[model samples]
Target: MERILPSGFRFTPSPAQLIGHYLARKLCDLPIASNTINDADVYACVPAELDSRFPSLDRFQDCRYFFTWRMPLAATGARVSRKVGSGGVYKGTQSAKDVVDANGRTIGYRQSFAYFDKSGKKTEWLMEEYGIRRQVVDGTKDLVICKIYLTPTARRACDRR
Candidate 1:
């Protein structure tokens, strides 16, 4: 039973809150503080359709977050095809960076991705994928929390240094 909230409601958790609280509880099979996060295969949908596909309490109604499995395409867990959801691929724009906790310990990883059109043209859509190194109860890779949104500015403006 999913509880739906108002559209204007905001769920702006910090990186630590997202990983330490929501994600950790989810993997441990514990109850979340709130039913604000949705478990979905984010790669299966396009960035533009996320809001309607997996709606949550978005801040300013401009962004969306999803909890998805970090399942790789091959058994080796090295190869993956991100090209799903309407014939486009969400290519990684940068390397995976560490998301540290208050004590400066790396608790999870974050990676940025930019969507490219079917013709290989870069779109204004952007995504930040966060994942941990721990495996789930089923012995799969860690679950991921993806923050997807359309860039408020030009694509390069959102490029992290």
Candidate 2:
């Protein structure tokens, strides 16, 4: 039996939905209907290569999302790490934003980073990584969901006539 989405279907989901629902289900080993979300160490691969590997992203011209497990940075012990890909490393801009639950309690965080080339030139590729803030027994098993997309500046540059 094949399942299909209704007409005019869109996968637009809020930050809470991504972390609280999807990411939570993933960490709990629950089954998710769509196969678009895959497990990957997003920091290990360049954005372009990572984007090409996912078949579910063929329809999206703008952004691609994935579920990744990010280890804590050794220096700061923060969720955002400075791990470099084959090309370069990812540098986060500001601190992570708090993801609050319906009861006004902080549940998770959303952090954004920019990819830089080997020459130290910043690329248009950007990634938003989301992770739960709640304490867990094994930190290594924690999974963080990330959304990778081109910056608006890059999009405009590409669309220029």
Candidate 3:
């Protein structure tokens, strides 16, 4: 094996961890990383195919769910964006009870997205057509929120229009 620095020489967190911290600090505005984003979350974009084939997805609506919403990134123009799919996400740990429909069929998946403004205001959107609720966790300002349900074909129509 090639010789390497001993464990004592290792930095407190390691270079990789430091880089992660630095990059996250540079990229993520929120001090707390939003649970909305993950490998699974990026893979969970609406029109599932777009999430899979990105940069080359045509007929996006064919794969099912899709949404386009904006939240404050810093000022008026900056924003964090999200596109959620209609088909359920495949997280492997999600319970059937969490995703199954009342009729015992799986409808689209439910995903929540949050983005914090530079002012430290966190705005969140829940993407799903059925049974959604909101809680005022604290005395923060509420931003404009909109929710719409789209079928695969409807999404395709919106894409062309």
Candidate 4:
């Protein structure tokens, strides 16, 4: 059956829906709707440049989401590397938050990161990375789903007519 959303409606999955449905389906090799999300190595470019790279994101003016394989940092043994993008790095601001399923079982983790320039100035870019908590299959441990967006301040300013 064809699943169609209302006109002008968007697929805004909550954090739990993201992990339990979309990300889980992807990892399990299940079918997801075509073009709902695209795969990109988001760390390679600044967030501002990401929307341009993925034309599918044209519908979303304030945020864009992508699936990418994050490399584990040797220093901290974390899934996301601190150094990413051109002359910039991503800094984690808080501890990983647990994503729970309907029965309250922890299904995944979510963490936020901010982009900083070479001079250590924080930019408007923010990333929310999500990953399954289960033991991943070999060679797929670093896979993650990321949602990139402008900071609230920047988003509000940009959205203002």
Given candidate 1, what's the lDDT at residue 12? 82
lDDT (C-alpha) at residue 127 in model 4: 86
Backbone clashes (count) for model 1 = 0
C-alpha lDDT of all candidate models, in order: 0.75, 0.76, 0.30, 0.76
In model 1, the clashing pairs are: none
Which run of 10 residues does model 1 get worst, by summed lDDT?
Answer: 133-142
**What is every candidate's alpha-carbon RMSD to the true fold?**
5.1, 3.4, 17.2, 3.8
User: For model 2, where is the 10-residue window of minimal lDDT?
Assistant: 73-82
Q: How accurate is candidate 1 locally (lDDT)?
A: 0.75
42-70: candidate 4 lDDT, tens digit per residue: 87877778866654333455576788887
lDDT of 2 by residue, 31-118 (tens): 9887656677887888888867764343445677888877664434444355667768888887889998777877799988999987
How much is 56 displaced in model 4, in angstroms? 6.8
**Model 4 scores what on Cα lDDT?**
0.76
In candidate 4, stretches whose alpha carbon ends up further than 4 angstroms from where it belongs are: 1-6, 55-61, 75-79, 134-141
**lDDT (Cα, tens digit) per residue for candidate 3, span 96-131:** 122343455442233333323234343221233211
Lowest summed lDDT window (length 10), candidate 4: 133-142
Model 2 CA deviation exceeding 4 Å by range: 1-7, 55-61, 135-141, 159-161
Clashes of each: 0, 0, 3, 0
Shift of residue 53 alpha carbon in model 2, Å: 2.0
Candidate 4 TM-score over all chains jointly: 0.83
